[model samples]
Target: MAADITPLIHRVRRWPRRVVITIAVVAVTLLAVRIALPYVVRNQVNHRLQSIPGYTGHVADIGIALWRGAYALEGVEIYKVSGEVRTPFVRARTIDFSVAWRDLFHGKIVSDILVEEGQLTFVAGATEAESQTDVDRRWQEVIEDLFPLEITHLEVNHGLLRYQDTTKTPAVDLFVTNLRLAATGLRNRPSESGEEFPAEIVLEGDSLGGGQLRLAISAEPLAAQPHFHLSAKLENVNLPELNESLKAYANVDVSRGKMELAAEMAGKDGGFQGYVKPFFEEVDFNNVSDENKSVLTRIWENVVQGLAWLVKNKARDQVGTRIPFQGRFGDPQVGLWTTIVNLFRHGFVRAFNPTIEGTVDPDNVLPTGDSADGEGVASEKPETPPKVATDDVKKVEPEAAAPTDQPSKKRTP
Candidate 1:
């Protein structure tokens, strides 16, 4: 019995050495993975980016945070391979994708993405090869591969959005700078109170020539069709700075003035209701001078300036009109006659107010009705006559406006 016990004790005494070796091996393996994970992720990202059709991209570096389950991409750039544009289509200084721990605690796994100093540029030319819209490719698939988790929140800080048209006479380049955007509740996690629109998005930016742009939206992003309420405003834009684009597109130029624009829209069940109001303040149309322009072009510019002067609201120093619209998601009816009437009304009867009307509401929007092309127009009712409402143009608070059951002659501008 003593001999058998001694043999068992010898084996038991060596167990610590075996355990220590096992632990050391695991520690070394984990250390190697930690050191190599970023390199592996960076290569994967670069590979996915290159797979985008007609686009090429590179990732400068990648960083990983093991504890938080986060990774950051630095100095990311994407270019359109076929375009003549020199600027990169997409440039991001840093993009961070992290696990949303708060949602994880609630038994919902999701991700939050932060994009810093990002720039998105769209170029247009005469040929298809010169266009860089990213619409032709499966860019979304690449984005999904980069972040496998469902995205519930997104933020963009100090970003830029640009549109360039090389085919224009003087070439067109317009940009929005210092753009900040935040969106939350995109996954539509169930709420205790059961909110209809579970997500909220806000965007604020500075347009070229010192104009401020703001947009806010409350939406059910996962709905089968479009369902949302939106409001937007672009104000105090120095019109002269927009001459390049205006001349190229509208064949008109502004020598002096500022502009203010506001719009409110609501959509549900594939139907939408909205209005776009544009107010020009102290505008002076530039004299058409280029000898290459057709005589009709110069005549049209003169007519537009004359009409603007005639409809100018003396009291407000503004020329403005409201263009209301409503219909299906893609096709909408514009109130051309109504818009013309509003111009005269603004000048003679009542000066148009440069604030969101707080009129459009999701609850008031009607579901889309079956109609064929050139059929009966939209069924939305006339907007309640304009009055000086709140001056909260930066952000609009959704209001429950009275729903109209009767068909309206109003159309969108």
Candidate 2:
């Protein structure tokens, strides 16, 4: 028995040596794959992106932990238009997200998306030029095709946005920064009757021109003409800090001024309506800084600024206001005071008239774009809080694209 036991022990010890060596080979192989994973992911992502209909851009680096059910992206840049650009239209510092473990094994991809420290730029006049490099495709459709995955939740932290239109006089470079946004129920499909719409969304941020911004929008985009309701507030907008944007877009600059704005618009069926009222609490316009501007433009700005100070409503310590609005979404019949007070003091006198590029389209649901070609118009009720409201959206065409119910690269300005 002793002799048999000794031989068995020897064989057992030698067998362990082979097992240890096999285990070591596997460990090294896994480590190698893990180290090489980022490169593989980067190449695959770039290849997929380049294959998009009209998009050509790349992801810089990726951090992957597939077993942990998550991945992250470091730098992402996509051109505003086709070909190389001095500044890419979209850039993100970190984009991290996770997928459901159950979904992965089933071969179905679903994810909760998060984006951090990103910027979206809209260059107003990019079209399919004569150059072969430039290709124009429907932005919303392109996005839907690229990210066909199901999304249940999303968050955006510290996002920056810019709207630039160099066609203007001083060139418009409007910015909104420090944006934090969240949403759910974004990808719901409609029933046979119609789609349940206006996915709840909350957005808060600071305007680079000096103001706190808040927006609540309910969006349901599956319909031919999407339905939505949006309420926006711009508080304590500093007039002086907006010199470049104001001077370029509206032909005015200020030394010291402050304004608060409240707007609630709802659209349904094919039209929309709402009221936009600007409250100027304390405003003092100083001067213009156009060394090479036209004589008429310079003189006009100075004259308007002077008139504002002289005739500003003293009782309220403000320049008088009016809630002027119009619409293709439906005429809520917003009131514009035609009284003598408005003639002397109003938003028009102090430059709060919202326009698209150079064309004034009161029908614009959010004071951001142009009139729509849809059949219906919008109107506002007499007294309603910023509760759930509805608006309709058709494509803004070259002006700006329509935003989807989710947060993604296809976000429109």
Best by TM-score: 1
Measured by TM-score, how close is model 2 to the native structure? 0.68
Give model 1's TM-score versus the native structure: 0.80
TM-score of each: 0.80, 0.68
Q: Write the per-residue lDDT of candidate 1 for residues 97-152, one digit (tens) a residue.
A: 99999989999789999988788888888887887776632876777789888888
Backbone clashes in candidate 1 total 5
lDDT of 2 by residue, 335-365 (tens): 4543334536543354333211112222344
> How large is the C-alpha RMSD of every model relative to the true structure?
10.3, 9.9
* Top of the candidates by lDDT: 1
